[model samples]
Target chain A: MSDDFERNLREHLHSEAEETREFPRRLRGRIRDGIAPRTRARMAPQLALAGALVLVAVAVLVVRNPHVIFTDVPSTIKSIFQQPTPSPTPQPFTCTDRSGGTTGASSQLSTIRTAPHDGYDRIVFEFSGQIPSYDLSRQDSATFVRDASGQPVTLDGSVGIKLVFRNTDAASGVQADAKPALISVKEIAQIGNFERVLSYGIGLASSQCVRVLELSGPARLVVDVATTASASTTAAPTPLPTQPAATDLGQFSCLDHSGGVDSGSAMQLTHVRVAHQAGFDRIVFEFAPQPGATAHLPAYTLSRQASAKFIKDPSGQPVTMRGSAGLRVVFHGASGATSYSESRDQTPNLPVVQEVAQLGDFEAVLSWGAGLSRASCLRTLELSNPTRLVIDVQTP
Target chain B: MLMDPTLGRVIERWRDGDRDAFEEVVDRYGLQLLRTARLILRDQALAEDAIQETFLKAWQRIGSLRDEDPGPWLTRIAMNESISTYRRRHRFQALTERFGRLGGGKVEVSTEARLDLAQALDRLTAEQRAAVALHYYQDLSVEDTARLLKVPVDTMKSRLKTALRRLRELTGSDEALA
Candidate 1:
């Protein structure tokens, strides 16, 4: 019976073999045409000899009468004899930090922002006062130092680095806070302060080449962590000698917004869907605005909470979700009249974003709980034309 | 294991730079190569393209032909080309689909007899499908298939067993086939 089954299976599988049985008449011709180029390429020595003869003839003529030879020779022959222009050698990237010999005034870090570019990500630390004297170093793991107590503070990710700023302090009164944004960067945290020096640990997805630049006008420190060494080609080269400008931000930067409180009326939430892409997993939130009123999606906070159950409704009740890492997405000026949710069990299984839950739509503020395999770099994008809020969480 | 003497001579002459001798090999192996590629890619146009590329590559590397019977060598090249083409096209389609430029389409089955088998094959991973094609359709031994796929013998066996079990389950679902 098994032999018969095998025979049947083979028969079924080979059923269409006959359709491709006859070799196309054009195939032999095409193969010959393809081989001809290589066959000719093999005769390069002979071709070069002939080209040299022509070049020698042109040289003799040009020496005899330079202006007459230009009128005499065909343009093609002239091009063949003319030397090929050498291509410009690309400059090797070098990291240069210009703090401009730090001002005596103490610096205050107000906000930290991250934006993803074609092949890299940029992290900007805006300061209120003088630019701080900083040291950027790659570490085996993201371990930070408390500037005030000399205690070790831990950050996320297996591999990362620390940025220690001397004579600097946090603008906010909080001692430490973790901010996770961009693709390669997992989180940025302010470890405790000690001895008037403020240290921050930058959690990276992996150890990558990082470049630091000190910008003035607003007195900010910019750190560009390359996703790949070859990523610089994806974006147009920015003319150096000047500070990295906001105009150099790629199209992906349009999704970036400062997390600020909003007063606009809420828009009705429509649908939510999860999709897995090559490098990251996406969670898209669809919204429909009230007629005759423009929908305004406020700058919302997206942070990794301690547990998936850490998210709560407006009435102050715990919301449950799947997975070990929880991402709480709070959208102000957004609400749903009728709530909708989906549980995505991906086939071939995505590395991150296991499950998503709609926590609440209470009081014109919509909130969602996303379950990730681990705490990772996350970015939010606001899209229009039927407004959508797209959140991408990177997977290692 | 004995190669046809005429085919052997043709291969030798092709290696000696007689371009016409290469056509003889093409006429002899083109259909078989296309069949093998179709088994992997499941697309006629893609199979044809793979075979054309295989022949061109074989022509260029004729000096490397060491096997007396070049059937397995040609089949291996065809399978590799087909898999690479499938992967490139799959990635392009996935990117286009993400941007909402393309829509999903059903696989076109050539005949009624192949409908069930084709559908069943589609459900298998690319590696599993390749294993089944090499072991069953091409009548290669598990060892030879493993070598062709650059996999360990035990891995190839496991893949074939899993594929056979899945195929049995699929065919068993149709009472008529069972």
Candidate 2:
């Protein structure tokens, strides 16, 4: 854009560049501070550069701290097994399990990781030896207190879960506040290390159902927070709200129960009604068939579900979440949009039914999901004369 | 630059994990690297940070350095660190600043005679600022500057030309820049 500077100006600028300056003050100290990890002195005079070319960035997480055999944990452990189906009995919200002491090379809390899964976000605390006795409980607020000094440690999200491991110590930088970018499990930070117990706080986007499990081989404490309600709601951690009282029929099965015939006018669903019955809550799926008084109800199936997402088979898409837990209801030889005039998704927020969602309607198979506050036992009934399928969910 | 007879042994000692010998390298080049970094970044504090990261990286990967003369290699590291810091800051704060440099020719340059040339260099992009500091202020040859920056000779010349033109427009010190 412009020609070269005049020769006289070029000479002047070159002279100005010759000005000398002193070295920056405290630069050596700053550089030393950056490499705060263990610095090995020349272990051998004839050590090769290849051997000395160790960058601590890779080992920083694992080798920061070392501990000997763990000791002084609770002797008795009540390690409860994970429930495969919704439990009729109430379970403790807090963990009281103890891991017996064992002699080992290192018994330190070495790594902390946070990840987001298909329907939940997982945070893992990995230890080098037998995992020490741990107590993990949900806190009402996100703020926490340091173990010994009692100073407050504030976290980022709204919900909090504090986990403490007795007779264990974490590496210095094992837990940083670098939470994963927008997820339910917000921040997992090591808030305190007093005496021999190591404490960590997990921040969440909202009140969530947290599942804790202990694994062997490397002995890691794995915690999973449901992205949506898996089996229990946060407010009713013990004795899920769906547990039936003595008057209702016993819940002997969490399996799918099916009935009704697939013949008669393709069963175009027309109206849906929900009500609280004597011993159960009812969802009625009424169909209009050929404007006739006599028609057979369509075949259908009902089962308890882990989540509302049906990524395979009929739904073929990610279904949205309504309540904490879900029940999937599938109907065969039925039409979803053929007769229904009202909205498919309903947020009734009833005592037993929090939401009624149309998960998918394809290939003459109709799928609907009921989002509930907690897992519940359900039974189905088929009625004739302008066919209807009634689902009665047993309630507390 | 020719290799200093003692500088070779100092680098060897550093590779052998001698902290003092590495500190000696910093004593030798810290001032020169500071000037280049300050001009490229135009921030006193960030230039210092660039030098700190430069030496830290040097310690971590010094075994890979292949030459006897540490000056050019050290300058290469410091220059790269400075440019990286410049890019990271602008990327997070002002992505549009890349296209709207020099106020997009909208805001008028100050009428008062400028006191700090570093302020005017900020109007140029990070690459232009680096090229100016290397070829003009640091007195490196065009080809040598291109080699240090890992850019083509024609690209380096283009940057120097466009950057010099804008420098004259802002500082009105054209006679000295050419």
Candidate 3:
């Protein structure tokens, strides 16, 4: 019966009688914007005149107070207007306080290890059940002591605290079933530039921090609060070496633009190194596996430009660029901080580059400029291979 | 704010002077608009007009829409406008017929076969009419039809089932419309 009913409806819908089912051409886009004729006709001239006035006003404002017009942008985009000047984190120093001093709190001072730098401060505390929110505003006696510069520093902004809770079985010491818990925070007070982080005690109630309500019960909670402040001249920082300005090397394909050939043939660049004296400041190369080639070039090396100069191998030896076989390029700093990585497969060709030719599977172009410091340049080129032909960046 | 990639995004883009986006929207749902309008007016030309007015109103007032789905919103507007036009035309015809009778002349009232179908339609209530329209013509499910009508699913189902039986008895057809 259902089948017959569906069949009948389909037949009725497709029959010649239903030829009128298609929407009228004249009413196509017109139907979506159902404006009344009288209002539309009347509003047209007035709207045009008003629009002209608005444009004129905008132009005049731009000519007079250009910054004001630009500043009128949404807050989300306006935040980007500030220059990214790196403000150093202040170093933490121990001091004896006359008030609010506690032996229990003093013992907990060694609980957290923070990054050593000026203008940095870190405090650690532990609690059971839900993590208690700290109210910095309540610390009215808080004051910043200057080193030698006699400059008084303030808490730069809001501090972020990491809350850690233990999860374990009570008797079995295994894992226990839990409930999803969430922490609700409210703004209690603001003192100085530091907004007090206030959290209501969850007590025995389940929190978002724990999966099992029972495990979250009587759990040891740890809170690590890190703060940053502007540097003071009292304590002189270490003198750094004078570095040269970075350069932007012009067009150069990381991978030969010519799609690589079969498994036997790999994309090869004989003499590739930093061309500093040249007009180009940076070298960007697009690479892809040879077309229809399953074979992979695990790595490649960049010899120094002086020895391997304009002829054979500039630096003499090749810096291995490898994924599975060998490491590619130079890796510096921490162990996880790799300066160079390889493409797992090929990234989808971008439409902009597709106009040139159907090239390899993916493309990677690295750029370095004269303004970029050595560390900054290395950090920028530090590619982390998360996917095929894809390298994501980790902010330092 | 995140980009509204669904109906809300389409409407937002249209509001932002992207007339081409409106055309894309039209291409996607034009037939559905006509079908929904036709259910009320039951006339192709008038349904097209209603559909046109519906889209026109949608373009103008789309900025005021806080919700995401434009389908139910557009359908409501189209249905209301079509019913308004139908009522106005019917009243005008009735008035003309009354004047003809006062002038001592027999009015030539041409009854359409569709009118007989309409009379059978009148057996059901107004809510039932909307339920039938949304279910069969608009091709909406019970839940969606309920959402469009601002009624509970069970209420909508009851209205539809009752409407179907009323229609069957009026037309004397045991065969279901589905």
Q: Write the per-residue lDDT of candidate 3 for residues A239-314, one digit (tens) a residue.
A: 2222233223111211111111123333322111222222122222223334473433323222111111111011
Taking all chains together, each candidate's TM-score versus the true structure is 0.38, 0.35, 0.31
- Cα lDDT tens digits for candidate 2, A230-301: 533433332224444533533323234666776645678888887877656788898866666347677776
Best by lDDT: 2
**What lDDT would each prediction earn against the true structure?**
0.66, 0.67, 0.37
| Model 1 chain A lowest lDDT segment of ten | A249-258
Error of 1 at B108 (Å): 22
Return the DockQ of model 3.
0.12
Model 3: CAPRI class? incorrect
Residue range B58-147, candidate 1, lDDT tens digits: 888777778567777787787788878877878865454345524544333333434366777765556677788888888889999998
Candidate 2, overall lDDT? 0.67
lDDT of 1 by residue, A149-245 (tens): 7787777765566676666777665436655566788787777466556767888775565666667767777777778746433221222221233
Clashing residue pairs found in predicted model 1: A147-A193, A147-A194, A148-A193, A148-A194
Error at A64, model 2, angstroms: 35
| Best-fitting candidate, scored by DockQ | 1
What is the clash tally of candidate 1?
Answer: 4
Compute the DockQ of candidate 1. 0.18
